[model samples]
Target chain A: MSDRMGEFDLIARYFTRPAKRAVLGVGDDCALLQPAPGMQMAISSDMLVEGRHFFAGVTPFTLGHKALAVNLSDLAACGATPTAFTLALALPRVDEAWLQGFSSGLWALADAHGCELIGGDTTQGPLNICITVFGEVPRGQALLRSGAQADDDIYISGTPGDARLALDALRGTLALPTELLAQARARLEQPSPRVALGQALRGIATAAIDISDGLAGDLGHVLEASGVGARIDPEIATNLIAGCAHAAAAAGLFPYEKLLEYVFAGGDDYELAFTAPPAARQAVDAASRKSQTQVTRIGSIEKAPGLRLVDAQGRSVTQTFQSFDHFA
Target chain B: MSDRMGEFDLIARYFTRPAKRAVLGVGDDCALLQPAPGMQMAISSDMLVEGRHFFAGVTPFTLGHKALAVNLSDLAACGATPTAFTLALALPRVDEAWLQGFSSGLWALADAHGCELIGGDTTQGPLNICITVFGEVPRGQALLRSGAQADDDIYISGTPGDARLALDALRGTLALPTELLAQARARLEQPSPRVALGQALRGIATAAIDISDGLAGDLGHVLEASGVGARIDPEIATNLIAGCAHAAAAAGLFPYEKLLEYVFAGGDDYELAFTAPPAARQAVDAASRKSQTQVTRIGSIEKAPGLRLVDAQGRSVTQTFQSFDHFA
Candidate 1:
């Protein structure tokens, strides 16, 4: 079925549709959408490169899913609901099987999330995927990093540093227990976007950001935005490390202090980290229960503006920080 | 500066802003935007590759401007008002001078058109640019290709085939008249998006699209969508073909019919082509008078579903049926 069509025909077959909630869709010069009542639209974009963002041998299906998933995670961080998306793909050459798998993966996520594919452009070049997602939130109601206030409690959903370990296993830098390796691979390939948790925190959380660049780096973003400081417990991070052989080896390579640094600085975790006032802790706890996600308190926002990692003895540890940098 | 700043800081320095109408712009997880009252938002995306879309040595400034310009032109085809844009760029490395020039060009256009830089992504890879633009139009009033009817007169704005000619000149395949070469280059590098013309046609034109892929190929899109055919005059197309020396040389390399073929099938004109009822002809004529641009009535819609081009002797020209195919 893929072999029978070219790019233009594929677009016309799969993407072109009349305006539904949209004022315009694929057929016209541009798509037109009407924002829902009393809501401002949230817009974000992300680009995935073949060698940089993912391994070259990974299936296009997983690539597509991960590409859109990362951008949707941004929407989740802002406490917005996904609405629509546009894709721009640059490929070295037309590969029917790759395109079929890619579209299938993209459509799956779009359908499940109720996000419509509205516009896209395909061209010949190195493999590159750029997606811009649109969502809706009530005006001025979006959660922002700058909203983190001094004395607010900082909490993170799910676990951290698992995706980084998965990458190590993939790179053959370490070995992993088979069962745990598979689970970590799945986490890396298809992350569960924290949309529900983000929406749940809209009214109660003081500030929030998705943990894409590991806990330490992303939390630093929140701290910088809010003009505050934080002192995180290293024991809690060490406990959160997944029990896999590769993780164990990677942990062995690092000193106890540096192991915690990996949890803080390694990236690709789509978990949400947020701050809330002390008064809202009970409500936050209840909301997390309702959302079926763990909300673990890690620290407190401080009046000063530097990040400190504290040992069990309550002494500051100095270590180099390493996080994913697009240009690096 | 480029080495010192990572992706986030670069975004903050260049893109973060609170524009006049934007509810939010840059810095956050997502940008928030509000559409004008009673107006539907129009959206379009285009991806430009370093080698395929433009020459390798093309300035970053022109590349940035052209990327946004082409998408904005799509909104113009829909008769919509410009509002906001998102950019997705992949690069091998961050070059400060390149980024500075690119951002300057993007911000210049955004400021001129009242479109804010709302959101986007940056990643590492071969150079590729994907830009999505948003605009607004009255509800249910967007210009559409499916709205053309039989017997409606077809009109095209500006001259055709210049960009293709300029491309040939740039590749050293053909020598162009010095005066014409500069004009052709300008047409290719800095396309004048038909925003005003589109706004003027909001109530009068039956159907419209921008002439990106020459006159004949794009008109065919309208014909196919509207379930109609067209009969265009070759003499009228010939009159619209500037840079005749290049055209004549190109004709020699290919065939005499090839000149007409390029005029009909060549793209990147970014001019408006629309079908208007005979009753609205006077209004179109009056509107055309306001600009130096000439609006030529070159064809009429037919009941059938194929395109035909007639010579001065009134014989159908088979070669003019050829059209540009992006994938082919």
Candidate 2:
């Protein structure tokens, strides 16, 4: 005989809670939500798979955090306020310990953002976590990738390559000191979603996108949508990598060329890349200070048709970096 | 070199389309939805896995239809008007033919309901389809499981046991004629969510739930939520099975007892189970005619604490049935 709990029991133990902001919550056929008057709803979904998104033996706690964080990142990119989310999970078995840790980590981030888990589904299958998040933004104030204009100064929030550095170190393709590896691993595992900064950037940043599939690739999306090109200062772009300022003094540091690749095409970095008019530079600084997140200017939107990597003196910098694609 | 399509190309070819109703659609970080003024959004998520939810060799078209249909069924249960949905899919490999069939089937149902495909994520992994659907209902008009009252009449939309019959036949446990099997298979595959019927019953029905986990189990949910019991006429309940009316005259028909079991405990029946005050029976009939969906009354809600199957003369009929549970 075995004492395995049923699906309903598992959900009641770990997932079910009283509705806070949602009109209706778990146990209902559909959760009900009423956004404030005249507010538009923003929706985004992300799926995380074992072995493809993370290592097989990774901790469930961080896995839960990362699953919801990637989705919240999209809301942040849209300059929307976090509201609610639904999680559809497929698990191979019912391990109570794993469930306890996973739900704990999930609630920690959810509570911080005031995003409630309204409703979801769980079934026995291969491990997959798909989260669809709902947020709210005032009409016409939400940021979009198609809003960039020529002469807008491009910017990035936080270090964008630290997660990739940690990934490479763990994958054994590169090496890092134990202390630095710990710092980078945290970036890979529990990267913060800049919800406050995104809200602060409303009406200020011309366009924005979260760096998930590398800075260069995601920025390419913004460029294509806005029908504008960008001239990124390679020197400044490479300087956005974590530990880049101390690279010369640090032993076992990778070369600047490799650092450029990490910054340009490293995936899993949940930082924002955005653009604003030069006249709004002070306003952007105020937003950055208000949200307590660092912002770095790295380039400018141009009327040209393609991305150009340039030096401090505007000399062409020759390089090629492929963005991460799941099926390429 | 191989000529496999990348994820973006696949999405553009098969998934991406113009934003018909959404403020922003595919290709953006998130889709924007503006529900009609004075409407509350109803949301639900469902996940289907290959081999567990469907046979490995099942047609991709039907898989697509079933995935979205099941999620829509939740909206229907809540008396919400279908608005849009996000699809999160993971495929083992890129199969052009499969993608063509799947997206076609998806759009066929989506177009019928005017539910646009808003935003989603696709990745490489074990095949899993997770869809989160959104719908709108006027405030205070949503049908909920907790609204059933004592002496309310219980009703079910359409037949409930045909899908289970088809499943049993496909599993080789039951025998069915070629033509009859095809009829049942369609019921098992592409279930028509009672969206119109749900809306028609908005003010008439007191409590509602879509029969996903068998008629007995789902009704149990309603009973538990409303703190009421139900007394179902065994004869009337068995008559709910498809072809049950012709069962006595037909050869190759299963016993009446088995039919009762099927109607009572069979799962995957997306038809709705609902209740209304006995005084509103005529109004319920008018709704049934308006929605063009048949409704059958088989029982009455009572203040008692448990379900009881009774004969036409009100004598108790002894039987036991367990509902399907994914992890039980």
Candidate 3:
């Protein structure tokens, strides 16, 4: 900490780069960006705290990746193309090695999406990372949570519960094989934002949301906004946990009850949950193939008022699950 | 904290509002904003940490105002018109009174500029406030630090150093009269960002920057970016502290040396320091009058390589001042 560079030098060394998409970049009072004509800017902000958001001993590289990934996930939900972002970070003290790893991970993800690093502030305090990301979408074409309608087919991109399984293992509440634990841990740490899939779903999906606070909770947001309900097939949802379906059933390792809970209420999975009319199923499939991401149809939107879990015969299944809440 | 509202309830009650300037406001994955055609969006972010930027027990109202005010000052420096902003806040615990007071203060200032609150994240952690503000400037019309030229007259808007004086008084390092202390403390807690003045100077001033890290250091940024130096008149600069001129000279309240130090090295003064060619002095005066903010000419940009303090006779005077640094 004592040997670390000053604030300006630290910013210049790690974050400063030539502007490719922005009219003005770092080192100015404000970064200037020109949104393309006929485009609307989509903006979102996310904050990651040391203990609340991540474990105390988590590596800086993954922390960096997850911080920006969460915000980018919001853009993905809006069907926007990545543009630029600003990072405001508070550190307990300056650590060059940590900074190097953090910035490397940040730039890797940013470069993959052609998102420019713009202007932000860095200060000394408890470790906190806040990123505000900007993206552009064609006017009136942004996928919104309020756009869902009855009879729409509900779909989710990628798996959603592996992160929670990993967290359970790390908490010593569950036992897992070493390789399985490693694979699940990566899901917990390095969330990949489905930017391309989001863009591909622009005209197809009626509504979308990023699954961060568990499937049940985040899906609730879309339902509430769209004034609709959903009926999810429990069998399909339970199988949405990658690699766990075969391993758990074949080895008779984890209980079915725990797997169900993880599937519904496992938070921190940066995947996309979207809804589209049944008529657009082929188009949705094409979008999935275009983005090279798998899509799973696990539910259907309904005119009812609450979420329901049903069996293959459409019989309601009673289950109690608690979604993640920051205040709670 | 245990009895507080849930995260979604808290946000819906306090932060959610109807969109006026933004295409979409709170309660969305991402807020949509449409900049008027041919306008460039100017963006900036600033983070404030408790125990570093503010005292442990500072009032929530002032903290809220100062947090957004500082970021608005950045837009002011760029000569942009405020549009919208996002706030990502971390709190140690939930307090209804704190939330009410903070949100009231935040909305009061935000409404003054017609800036809408878009989208952000809230979580449980050590207290921190990070705001990313957006504004718009006509293309190629932003006031930048790199636009200064030799012989440009440097000006200061409003008064500087009163906030620092109040801070010193609070620290018990200085003694000020009761009434004077109250006035200065208000300046420290509730700064008025010169938004109108910045917009007024858009086509007049060559370069501009807000005095955050003290006048000397922030001015250094303009000078470095413009590849120019400056000569400041200490006598004029020292008198820029509000209400201190007659009080200090007549009553001998504070030392001249300390006053000078505060004038140049005092941070947290959300005032604008700008430069304009001498030929535009009348236009500058008109801008100052139009914005209802006072402006004073205290220095002149030069072709030399460093800042120099000069007496009335134009002879160099030796003085050293250390600007505030987060890690220092």
Best by DockQ: 3
The digit string of per-residue lDDT tens for model 3 on B21-119 reads 899999989999999988999999999999888898988888888989999999999999999999999988889999998999999999898888998
TM-score of chain A of 3: 0.97
lDDT of 2 by residue, B219-304 (tens): 99999999999999988777654442224214546777777777888788899999999999999999999999989999999999
Worst 10 residues of 1 chain B by lDDT: B241-250
Q: What is the C-alpha lDDT profile of model 1 across B1-328, one tens digit per residue?
A: 6665778777777667765677877777888888877988888999988877789998778777788889888988898899888888887777889988888878787777888888788877898888989888998888988899999999988766777777888999777668768888887877778787887888889999998877877888899889999888877666654444335544465555656655676687788899998888899987677544668888888998888887678898776344555466
The per-prediction CA RMSD against the true structure, in angstroms, equals 2.7, 1.7, 1.4
Report lDDT (Cα) of residue B66, candidate 3.
93
* Winner on DockQ (2 vs 3): 3
DockQ of 3: 0.86
- The list of candidate 1 runs beyond 4 A from truth reads A1-4, A13-20, A240-255, A311-313, B1-5, B13-18, B240-256, B290-292, B311-313
Off by over 4 Å in 3: A1-4, B240-250
Query: A263-321, model 3: which lDDT tens digit per residue?
Result: 78888888999999999999999999999988999999999968999989979888877
For candidate 2, report its TM-score: 0.98
Candidate 2, residue A231: lDDT: 96
Candidate 1 local lDDT, A63-149, one digit each (tens):
878988998999989999988888888877767788878888888887778888888887778888889898888888899889988
What is the CA-based DockQ of model 2? 0.82
lDDT of every predicted structure (CA atoms): 0.80, 0.89, 0.89
Q: Alpha carbon lDDT of residue B58, candidate 1?
A: 81
